[model samples]
Target: MEYIILVITFTLFIIIAKDLAHHKKKNPVLK
Candidate 1:
């Protein structure tokens, strides 16, 4: 159960990071 939770957390982190990156790219003014 612990391992599964860790995996889920990692996946969410990666997804959020990717989304932020995409948003920044879409709006260069963000940087």
Candidate 2:
């Protein structure tokens, strides 16, 4: 159960990171 939770959290982090990267690319001012 703990391993499943960790995997889910890691997946969420990757998704958020990708979104942040895309957002930064769209708005240079964010950098």
Candidate 3:
């Protein structure tokens, strides 16, 4: 159970990071 939770959290973190990077590329003014 603990291992499953860890994998979920890690996946969410990577997804969020990619989203932020994409937004930055789309809108340089925001950065």
Candidate 2 lDDT trough over 10 residues, lowest sum: 22-31
C-alpha local distance difference test of each model: 0.96, 0.96, 0.97
Give the per-residue lDDT digits (tens) of candidate 2, residues 1-31.
6999999999999999999999999998987
Better of 1 and 3 by TM-score: 3
- Rank the models by TM-score, top first: 2, 3, 1
lDDT string, candidate 3, 1-31, tens digits: 6999999999999999999999999999997
Ten residues in sequence with the least summed lDDT for candidate 3: 22-31
Q: For residue 9, give model 3's deviation from the true position in Å.
A: 0.4
Candidate 2 clashes between residue pairs 3 or more apart in a chain or in different chains: none
Instruction: Report the lDDT tens digits of candidate 1 across residue range 1-31.
Output: 6999999999999999999999999999987
Q: Tell me the TM-score of each prediction against the true structure.
A: 0.83, 0.89, 0.85
TM-score of 2: 0.89
User: What residue pairs are clashing in model 3?
Assistant: none
Residue 2 of model 2 has an lDDT of 100
Residue 30, candidate 3: how far off, in angstroms? 0.9
